[model samples]
Target: MLSDLLMLAAAVVAGRDIVVKAVRARTVGIDLLVSVAAVGAVIIGNFWEAAAVTFLFAIGHALEAATLNKTRSALAELVAVAPDTAVVLRDGEQREVPAAQVRMGEIVLVKNGAKVPVDGQVVAGTGAVDEASITGESIPVEKAKSDAVFAGTVSRGGFLQVLATGIGADTTLARIIHRVEEAQDAKARTQTFIDRFSKWYTPGVMMLALVAGLLSGDVVLALTLLVIGCPGALVISIPVAIVAGIGRAARDGILIKGGEYLETSAKISAVAVDKTGTLTEGRPELTDVVVLDPALDRTELLRWAAAAEAGSEHPLARPILDTARAEGVAPVGVPGTVTPVPGKGIVSDVGGRRVLIGNPALLEQYGVTDDAGAAEAARGLAAEGKTPMIVAVGRTVAGVVAVADRVRADAARMVARLHSAGVEKVVMLTGDTRLVAESIGRAAGIDEVRASLLPEDKLDAVSELQREGHTVAMVGDGVNDAPALATADIGVAMGAAGSAVAVETADIALMGDNLLKLPESISLAKRTVNVMRQNISIALITVVLLLGGVFAGGVTMSAGMLVHEASVLVVIVNAMRLMRRTQGSTATPRSRWSPARPREAVDA
Candidate 1:
């Protein structure tokens, strides 16, 4: 920059009638304009104005570049964690190999502190892994054999042989990188304003310079006019603000992928929250137990259902197994045959009797929906967002287990804050039944509820809402929530234990588990956006004032440039003030959301 400015100074001293430098240096921003204007100044010997104009533009560019450079460090950090090779296990022997060369079913050994090189299943070892770089959790997670691991995660302990099912760009880390890059490139409202401003400003300045040249017999005046209207500083105002906003958010536990989400978040008319993980603790507890028959005790039913569920992998299964474990009720181990019915439930053998553990679909198969009591229990469970697991012996239902996701302590107040920030609607969406979704919705002060949606169907809901011309923000925390997150106008991911693929895929992510940050983030964005519009107005007004005085004296080319530079500084300073305001009133969190209210609500 210094070199460019000095070159402009040298070019100016050469005077208007004698130009000799190549086109390369002449195309280098304000320096080129300053160089031509400076030559005019020297030919006319207005040296002070020529040098000052060049100096102001150089400084503006420097500051603009500085503000936008924050993203480079994060990108660099990501690259540094990216592994270059893998330890491929072939024929029971581990061999050093390139990550890309490792095909499907290849086993790779990853040790502590080493990044997992591919998306694969852990075939051996029990160790804790830190996926926080991806999940934004501060705690390292325990991983065991048969557990899935993604690339770029740090194995905190133990040595593992991971069987590679996904490699290269197909890895979870790769997808995250791709999503982050895409979000970065996505245009923000503020960027559009700057683009539009520059597109017209440049041409308008050129025309103004021509008019000045026609009116003034001196060509130097026109050249000076061109120097006065350089759009360099004005072009960078909002981008610098956005870059800084993203950087500050990263520090506070939010990863804003692009300026668009940041800008849109400031204007969200309605916030559609995912109840299970967005506004709640998401970890459901085994809270209710009902026996279907007086002959079967509750403990026996829970034990058998847990035994059957031991082989099943589902979030709902954990509470049943965990409750059985806690009650000292040993699960029945006599499992000769077990078959998991897809999307319905699990059927297995217990002490020579077939036990079915699942929802209503499973009950209907056995002609066991015979009593009003059983149907009512299922209905009651659905009402509270609890999935009822029925444990049956022969064709008779023996026991029922009910579970509910715990809600965050701060969710209700957060909704109120969002409402205060201009959110017109607060809706809750969940795959849990209508009763559960509605129950959780009312607890969190949500105005509406959409429940029992499949993952793809959730995307359709977002599309339907967008078609209504509403700017929507979807907050979610599950891997199942990814498609909807991608489909929403703005996707906000809960960063903690939420899936890495989901977090990476989201436009914005809450880094810590504190969900109240959602409202805070929206508020901060609103203030910054408003400040940006104000700055542009101020900048354009300054341009108008400077142009009006261009020929009438007191507004030399250098003087106009100085005022423009000052205006740029003023805007940058104003935008930086947002970083100091609390995103809400506290720190940050990225954990899941779950409803924790009682089975029924109390009128306040």
Candidate 2:
């Protein structure tokens, strides 16, 4: 009698919430199945069976909650880094205030080793910031005037007076946190199907158990069926994997939009990149100035080029102006009038004479003969990987000036890593001439180069790759690349912290400018998808084996519960592995972005 009372007490205590939920919902669930089975066991005078079933189910629920929280640790860590207070300059005095209370455009002071309280631009002083919280890189990056600094990052050294651009929820850290939360909650395709299957599968199990109990007069068998019919592991299999995978990527500064995007990213077979900023420095420098006229020298040619480009806003104009000023031949003033010719170059009126600086096509358009072989000279420079421009004074060809943008040190390694990550093709699309594009392409180990493309042409290139049955990921950081980015299967934005559009719109936004993160993101996606598949298999196999054992006559109510709970725990444990950093995820600062040594120099 005492043992039966103890069993009754345990069943009521452990199964109270489960019974209450089933009553309130007026629907069947795993909770209802477990509750009814425990009640039936007690009615049948199986006191020990009743107590053990309820106790094990309760214990399993507790363990699942605890382990699932561990999988979301990445997001928890990010939330912990948000700054609570800030030091701001108010009326020429330093004051401490809540980070969110600081007004926009306020000048916030960050001391050495202090956490930056707002996203802003550094206006004074210098420092080394440990941006691991933002970029997931452990190295300290040096900061200076005009450099962007994010909130929740620590200043490793020096002090800074920053102009606040973003505060409170407007900051990048806040956006990342919000994005991660949404991604974790979003369901994957496989998960949706599993959910639909469970909706009917649970009721079907109860009906099958009832029919078997009535047909064979076996009450013990019916009780065991309800205990094992919970579908605990199978229902949660895909969701746990997705949460862990998305959370893991967040810690590494890669934000996947949602589970749908993760599945797509895993299938990325082709990568398309923009040439200007994706592969090169994007900053061009004047390298050579050849004077075609025997009467003029290098200085004279540079001076004319600078004079025409004086009033221009073109990217190539800055290098010419900077070089001319350094050589003490800066243009006295802006050109009187500057007219730009699309796809060609600029036509400017400098000193009451028409100065044309453009490609050979531009000279031909204006009916200017290429005297002194200026066009041929420009072609020679282009062959050497320089962007050459022909300079003309009225109808006579003046000279050729060449500018070159240096290829990023990690360009080749990034391409090679993409291939290793299973990308079959790495293509570069640019508006540069074929010669200039091929030069950088060879240096970067690019498999395909599509040159002299307009913005629409870039979109067409992505479409062409898609028609060839390739899943393409477009990597770029320019306004012109927006259409192509949207057209590709996955849009990757590098150095996205500063671009609000990229952060919000990209399929995967890599917070840092590290070239290696591109391949890392792809590899991570693949691993995550594999985990999802493995988890599904484990859940399904466990269910099938437990059902077979119960009918085959050795499995009891308590034993089946134990095995079901164990399978759920195993799935959660497998997902947690994604939280750990994989091999090659990081490298020493010296090996990152540093120029490669020449072949001859290395041999020596």
Candidate 3:
């Protein structure tokens, strides 16, 4: 009698809130059904069974809460990294204040081992900042004047005075947190169907239990059915997987938009990458100086080219001027009377002699004969992916000065890794000439090349890929690629730490500039989707077997509750596997070219 009273008290303690919540909400939940089943067991004098059912459920709830929080721990870690205090220069005095209180344009001081309190530009001093929180890069980046620094990064050494550009909730960390929460909560199409099924499955199970008990006159069997038919695993299977998958990606500095985007990312087959800033270094550099005039040496050729470009504002001018200065061949001052011809090059008067630096068209425009085979030399440079400029002094061609963008050391490795990751085609799209684009493509191991494309033409290329039944992912960094990015199946933005638009709008935003993350992201998405499928199968098979066991008569109430809780724990633990780092998650492939050979050789 004492055991029965104690067990009844235990059931009431475990079930009161559930009963009250159901009453207040005027709805029937699985918890209410379980509570009813426990109470019925207690009334039938099955004291141990009643106590075991409610106790197991209470234990399961506690475990679920703890483990679910662990699945979401990655985002919690991000929030914890947010700066709390800041040292700001107010009225030329350093003052400590809350990070959120620091006003924009105010100078913030960052000392050694201090966290950067705001996203801003470095105005003075130097430091090595560990930006792992923002970019997931383990190495510390060297920070100096005019360099952009983000909040939550640590200054490993030295000091800095930064002007606050973003503060409080406007910071990137806050935005990342917000995006992660929204992504975790978003539902996929399969999840939506399962949710709908669970809603009706609970009440339907209750009705089946009621009819079975009345017709068969077996009250204990009906109670056991209620304990096992909780839909615990089915309801939480997808959500836990989604939370763990997205959170793990965020920790690695890969931001997937949401569940829907994650689903689409798994289906990506083709990838289109921009040449400049994506596959190669965006900055052009002086590579070759061909002397057509036997009288002038390489240095003299560079000097004449730099003199002609000294007064021009073209994108290719800085490389010439910088190289000239490095080689001690820079002109004394800027050139005189510079005339820039669109689609050609610049013409200027240098040292009282007319200097022309451009393509063959510019030479023809000025009626300068291709004396000394300057045009053929320019074609040779162009074929090797170099932007060739003819240097002419008076009517005689001096030399052909060539400049080319340096291809990234990791470009070829990135292509190979993408293919290894199951990508069907890796295409290079660029506004550069056909020869230049093809040269880069060959070096990078790209499968196809779409050259000399305008911004709109890039979008057309992506659409054409889609029309061919290939799901395309476009990776780019500039505003011109934004249209193609939006039109592709998956729009990937790299080096996205400073770009607010890319951070918010890209399907997958890789915070660091590393190209390896591209293949890693796709691999992760594929693995995550596989986990989701496995979890769903586990849930459905568990439910089917439990229903079968209850009808065939050997599963008791205590045994049913234990199995139900075990299934839930299994699903949670399966999802947590995604949180751990795998070999493919962090692989940085080696360059295909030998270390002894210069990267410029490939560009040539």
Candidate 4:
């Protein structure tokens, strides 16, 4: 009798909060059902059954909370890495203050091995920063003056004075954390249906338990029915899967916006990529120098062109100046009196004579005829996918110099992997001319080319693909592509570690600059969605079998609770499989291509 009374006290200790919460909320939940079953067992003189039910429920709730937090550990780690304090240079004296108190435009000092406290420009000194926290790239990137640095990245080797541009919640790390939390909390379509089903299913089960007790006069059987019909596994199935899948992705530096975006990413049939920065290196290099006038020679032609461009800031000017300096024919100083002929080129005084370097349009604008076959040479270079500039010396054509942006080493391989991962088409979109865009498309193994696009024109291309019943993913890195990126089914931002806007606004943000991560993100999404379906099925089947066993007279109150707890554990363990690193996640196969033969011959 004494031992039975102690067991009764244990049941009250475990179940008081649940009973009080049910009373205050004025709603029917699984907690109330379990509490009522325990009380009914006690009133029927089943002291052992009451103690067992309440003790098991308490232990399961504790375990569930602990394991659920583990699934969200990735986001937790991000929060822990956020810097709490910063060393600021206030009034020329170094002062330590809370990271949130650091004002914009104030200089903050980052010592070796210290965490970067704000997103800002490195104004003085240099360092190597391990940016794994931001970009998910493990290698330390060299940061010099004028380079951008993000908060939460560590300074590995040198000291730096950074001008704070973003602090506290405005930093990229903060935005990433907010996006991840929102994603984990957002419900999928299936989850919404399950929620509604659970609400009515619990109350209906309680009514059935009362009817069974009335018809058969078996109090124990009615209480056993309540124990097995708790809907514990069904309630937790989808949330655990979503949290695990999204948290694992965050660890790998892939930010999936939410459950809906994850669902959409699994159906991506086409990917439209910007050519300049996505397929080819955004930087141009000097490639060819053809002398139209044999009398002037290569050195004289380059010298005149370099002098004309020395005072200009055009995108193509750096390559010409760099090549001239390397060849020992660069201009001694900046040119005198430079005039930019809009959309054509520049005119400058080199050695007291007018030197013009641009397209044929510039020569026509200035009434300088190309008598040395310079126009013909420029046409040949342009046909080869190079930007050619005509160099003229006082109305006489000197030579044609050309530059081209080199394709990234992994671009063609990225296309092949996309095809292997089930993408039906890879299209190249760019503002470049048709010749240049097609040339890049062929080299990158793309199926279609939409060139000479304005910023808005890219959006129209994405819309056109959708009209054709394709789910399009647009990948880009610049502000100009923001419209198209926002309009696509999935907006993927590449090399987004440096841009806070990309981290916040992109549907999917790749922390590193790897091209292969694009296909990998889609593949992971498909796998995660598949796992979610499997888990939901496991939960519902477990619930059905338990209910059948109870009515068939094989399941008792204690046995039903055991099976229900076991099913919940099963669902959670299944979702944990997403945390493992996939085999061949990093390897990219090379696509075969030859410069001597056309792309058709090699690809075919």
Candidate 1 residue runs with Cα over 4 Å from true position = 1-22, 25-29, 59-193, 196-200, 218-220, 339-346, 359-364, 369-372, 381-385, 477-479, 496-500, 581-585, 588-604
Predicted structure 4: lDDT: 0.82
- Residue-wise C-alpha lDDT for candidate 3, range 1-604, written one tens digit per residue: 8877898898778767656765675556668777878888988989788888888888888898899999999999998889899999888788999998999999999999999989999999998888888877777888889988899989999999999998887777777888889989999777888878877888998998899999999999888888888888888888888889898899888999888888788888999999888897777888988898889899888888888888987777878899999989888888778987765667899988999887777888899998688777767877887777888899898988888887898889899999988899999988776777888899999999998788899999999999999989999874879899989989998888866877888989988877888888888888888888988888779878987988888788988889988988999999999999878665332121111111111112
Local distance difference test, candidate 2:
0.86
TM-score of each: 0.74, 0.95, 0.91, 0.87
TM-score of 1: 0.74
The lDDT per prediction is 0.68, 0.86, 0.84, 0.82
Clashing pairs in 3: none
Q: In candidate 2, which residue ranges exceed 4 Å CA deviation?
A: 24-27, 587-604
332-395 in candidate 2: lDDT tens per residue? 9889999988777889999999999888788888999876887778777777768888899888
1-604 per-residue lDDT for model 4 (tens digits): 9999998998888778766766676668878888889999999988788888888887787788888899999899899989999999999899999999999999999999899999999999999888877766667888889888899989999999999998888888888898899999988777888889988999999999999999999999899888888988888888888888888888777899888888788889999998876787777788888888878777888888888889987767888899999999988888888988755677899878998888787888889887877777776666676777888888787888888877888889899989887899999888766666777888889999987777799999999999999999999864778788988999998777757778878989987777888888888888888888888888889878988998899988888888888888888888888877787365332221111100100000
> Which candidate has the highest TM-score of all?
2
- By lDDT rank, best first, the candidates go 2, 3, 4, 1
Model 2: pairs clashing at backbone N, Cα or C within 3 Å: none
lDDT of 1 by residue, 1-604 (tens): 6665565564454332223332354333434555566656656655566566656656665675564554444444555667888888788787888777888888789998888888888888888777655554457777888877777778889898888887887776666555555554566776887787676767677777878788777676787677767665566567656755654455344667778878888878877777765666767788888887878787877777777777665677777788888999757553777787765677887668787877667778767654536657767776775666666778777767778776677889888998988888877776666777777787888888887777787788777778877788888764667787777878887643225554555667765566676776787677767876776777677667776777666677767777777777777776666556463545433343343322221010
